[model samples]
Target: MWIDKLKDVSFDGRMMHNMSLASLSYLNIGGVAKVVCYPLHVEDLSNILNFCFCFNVPVLVLGNASNTLLSDAGWSGVVISLKHFLTKITVENDSIEILGDIRLEKLLAIASKNNIAGFEFLTAIPGVVMASINGNAGAEKCSISDLLMEYKYMDIQGCSHSVSKKDILCSYRKGPLQTFGIIYSACLKGEMSQKDLIQKSVKEKWEYRRNRQPISERSLGCVFKNATDYCAGQLIEHAGLKKKSVGDVAVSDIHANFFVNNGRGKSIDFLNLIEEVRYCVQNKFGVFLELEIKKVGD
Candidate 1:
């Protein structure tokens, strides 16, 4: 069996069997995961990946779980979390080399300390560096891809590769690595500025998101990507679906695109609300909103 073969692999990091996905997801909603592994280093991850590949077991790689929704039916494959692994950051003269697991908050503090100006927009993101780069996490002006110089990723075969930013295909809320491979590290360039100026920018970015988003609530960030012609939040709000509810989940009145878990919300409730809002928005505007968040599991 695959389970038996997994025991023979050389893995040194943490492992949880039959773990609850709710504990890992930012939405705090989901059923159990068959197995979750946290690799200590690149080789450890490669080993796990190699094992999975050889056994033909499906695999899912996740960072902070901020931009993903884990289904209630649960994933039958191995879930690899880089949140506790590959978290290293080094600052050069005007650039930064960061690992996958580093959180945006920590990166922001470090960048500000180093007088880096361009990273202030990251204050609006609540995820780790790799996932942010994978999703091209961004604010009004720019995305994470704007700061990237080059990135390293491991393929499904456990082989590592690097690609320069000039070779990367990046767009709003999307990046090249989203479907290709697992990113482990990246080099990003930023402008040198006064520390106080950087701090001010960070604070302003934080304040903007704090006032606009339901920061204190449990959610999978924005539910729908903006349509070609209109903002998803504005459309949902115009449809009068703000504060719309399904079981314990409700669309945030503060930001109609975000559906918050009031308490004890299930993934099903979130999914139901998503459908209802999508139907309402489409019926009113004739636009079918695409999901911004990644949905995992059956």
Candidate 2:
């Protein structure tokens, strides 16, 4: 019935029935999802949200699925992805207004072209702008919140609100938009810098990540959040979890905190590996590692 009714809704985007979540995720490890919808713009997205809310159908909004671990059991309700559309960037003096669905790579490109500096640290970061902002994603003691001046979001009831950065609470790996239903757009401010310098910074950051992280592998980014005063990767390596495996998934040898899928890896195996790593790190370092990757379904 839900599927039938979903078809009746006026949607201005693509939809797939019984879509495989693995195809959408960076880890490439998840079961089928009942429905996956890619809404083009805010109006299309709002319509889908309202329909799901009215029918009491569960909803999950995914960006790039870079840091998400979807279950093998699959999602029962609608899964909304904004990666296909809603990508618009406007440069206004020293500020940039970005739509939620813009990919980090695209954002960085545009920023560089416009001589916007300060986001060089996000050179090779996966996922879209919304997901990055949601997790306050960054490295080298920098974060997306650094440039964020304001953001706009729509609640579950499809009502939109704009919020200033000064009024929001943002930390190392968390942002104030968690409770909000969906972030539609954001304004980020950056310093006006020389194009050559920005490009050089971006290249250096990208190379640094490429050498240290298992960027080419199928992974869900960092598996654990760093403990206070300790890096998560160092902790995991110190715990002797490097190359630890369950099924086809294993802790990346390059980065101990990253779990990479070799091939046909199951979500259950990934979960098991997490437990194993957590136990090892806890026992060895007396720190119970906290998960940084978001788990969904099952």
Candidate 3:
């Protein structure tokens, strides 16, 4: 359908259909995408968007897929990846403008090198800048949205728009970015600090994360968002689901909130585990858990 039209766009990266998603996601699950297009520049992305708009075709803007769960049945439309468009970091007196495709880890390293203190907490996060912004991704101390000053994006109709931090309602892993466009770049406001101090802080946070999380494994960071006055990990642990397994997907022994994919794990197995954990938590306590990870395409 839309595949024929996609050939018109001058893409610098790979473009393919029926591509396996397991290689893309952190959890290493999911089937395939009908069409996966990685455009090299913003213009390429804009052209594709315009084509999609004219034909009423659906588009899925994917980042690094760290927090995404794709169904085994696969995505049926255009899946645009911004990975190839990453470029340039301009550091001003008090702000940093970064391209959207840059990974958060790389951004954090850049900030640390520049003595930018605010982004230190994000070093341990495992996704791209756009994905972090899309979810307002964060931990206990900070979120990506909190440091953002403004962002440039192409709307679904292929029109460019700049949104300021104030224009968005950002809170607890949720952002005001509508699911109908592609983020190009963003400017972040951060405080400058001494190099040694920033480095020490980053190291400390990294150490804490390493000690507490099974971050090196194949897992989708956190499964559920923390409810008010309670941690989802704590709840899952209390529900007696730690080390629980459904096929090859298992609740991480180190962290109950994380669902790990052992060898040959299926997307359905991970989904089943989510439902089982939710049921157990709801039955044991009166609270229903909310998913932090995004699930798409069946």
| Candidate lDDT (C-alpha), each | 0.86, 0.87, 0.84
Candidate 1: tens digits of C-alpha lDDT, residues 1-298: 8976777889889888999988888888888888999998998888998888888889988878898888999889899988678577889988999875788888888888888888887786789888888888887767889898999998887889899977989887887775557889899899899998898877887788999999888887888987567899999999999888999999999999999999999888888999999899889899999999988886
lDDT of 2 by residue, 178-289 (tens): 5747887999999999999999999998899999999999998888887669998999998888999999999999999999999989999999999998889888889888
Rank by TM-score, descending? 1, 2, 3
The TM-score that candidate 3 achieves is 0.95
Q: Measured by TM-score, how close is model 2 to the native structure?
A: 0.96
| Residue pairs with backbone overlap in model 3 | none
lDDT of 3 at 119: 85
Runs in model 1 lying further than 4 Å from the true structure? none
Per-prediction TM-score: 0.96, 0.96, 0.95
Worst 10 residues of 3 by lDDT: 1-10
